[model samples]
Target: MAEGRSVSDMDVDDVIAMFPKIDPFLIRKWHYAFYTFFDLIGNNVIEWKDFQSLIDAIGAVRGEGSEDHVAAKVSLTKVWKSMTDTMKKDVEDEVKSTSSWKLHVHSSKPCDNRKTEKVLF
Candidate 1:
């Protein structure tokens, strides 16, 4: 060891001792292997274990009280409103055309009246 030089030049232990109040950072998925092989830790990152823990934690939160009901609640009010509109349109069309237009105007209602129906997209 050289005299009058900094501790970083002397040993790895001296360098680690300088910063003793920090948590080791985690890397997500493949980054864990990077940290392990490089003997290094990132400042702030999500490791694979952390992500899995998050997924498990979310599942645990969702499963509270009713473990059998694992259904994710989504707001389908918009979808239902659209369906109601479509149904209303169909009903109005049925009332207007009655079976008389079958011999005359035929398919011109702006809606696809095929039995299979079509997706707008």
Candidate 2:
């Protein structure tokens, strides 16, 4: 399931199915938001690496002390500041709506000879 395609060629529903607990609506919303925010439509799909990049970026801010984390946070902060008011509001609203959501990040541990990383939400 992890091979044979570039990250931008991954199917949305397939990725969503990987995390059963997260609200599909929320995932879909973020999918579209990321799509727009990252300008990922050139290939018409969001790949696994893209999703991992998002998680890493968020984790850099949310995770504890590390030089890499600090650097990622600084980069994200600059991008966040550069975002338009509407874009910021959209993100704020999405976050507010999912404030009560249960999200969990799982490592890409190998299982059955395959590596699957899950960011549950």
Candidate 3:
């Protein structure tokens, strides 16, 4: 890991080296998704506050009390709920570590029968 950075901040090469058994492509995808979406505040961990940032951003653009903003909050809240449900842990009580996130990504199977991995990017 980079100096002063958490394991979540490790580059692709470091991640690949750490989990050599996992596919490199899948590792890259998971890393990309982690940084792009989960680590919204760049803290290297997934927390409710990160999701709140996304909700706040949507509210800023759509107007705080507007329908769109309210809808975004509702939708994101549901997403958070589903994620916590899947993990069987409360996000508000504990942050999701990057290692656990990686495991979750690795364990998930492609939703369809297509040979290609889903293109998240």
Candidate 4:
């Protein structure tokens, strides 16, 4: 498991496995949250950075320390490394491309695209 590797290649099951004590259903819900959040930038996958942030937030809420963070990172990284090279590249490219694109909303009159071409990224 590489420290700098992304976790986008890992599936929902692998990601949820990091939190052994948590309910898998709850983790799936969080995955959906990440999915919806990334949808804003045209990304359907949850990259390692996004998952790490979510994990960090949860750890903070639960008063978790560095040990938990380390363990989560290691678990996720192991899954990430198990992914194929092509999948890894695809995930990396998606993250870079989506993150680079900006969401620009233009509304001149009503809430319609007729007034202005809404470029929602």
TM-score of each: 0.18, 0.33, 0.77, 0.33
**CA error at residue 61 for candidate 1, angstroms:** 8.5
Clashing pairs in 4: none
- The local lDDT score (0 to 100) that residue 88 gets in candidate 4 is 34
Task: List CA RMSD, all candidates.
Answer: 27.7, 15.0, 4.5, 19.0
lDDT of 2 by residue, 21-96 (tens): 7677756665655555443324443233333365476676778546766666566544433332212334233221
Model 3, 1-121: lDDT tens digits are 4446568567778767767788988778777877887689887787788889999998899899789889989977876776665566675744466666666656655542121123223
In terms of TM-score, the best-performing candidate is: 3
Q: How far is candidate 4 from the true structure (C-alpha RMSD, Å)?
A: 19.0
lDDT of 3: 0.70
Q: Roughly what TM-score does model 2 have, to 2 decimal places?
A: 0.33
Q: How much does candidate 1 score in TM-score? A: 0.18
> How do the residues 31-85 of candidate 1 rate in per-residue lDDT, one tens digit apiece?
2332332112232221233333433554687774344223321212232233235
Q: For candidate 1, give the lDDT.
A: 0.29
Model 4 CA deviation exceeding 4 Å by range: 1-42, 84-91, 95-121
Of the pair 3 and 4, which is ahead by lDDT?
3
After superposition, candidate 2 runs with Cα above 4 Å error: 1-5, 40-77, 80-121
Q: For this target, which candidate reaches the highest lDDT against the unseen true structure? A: 3
lDDT of 4 by residue, 33-88 (tens): 44564333334543556656756765787657677766766765543333213133
Cα lDDT, model 4, residue 82 = 31
Superposed Cα RMSD, model 1: 27.7
Give the higher-lDDT candidate: 2 or 3: 3
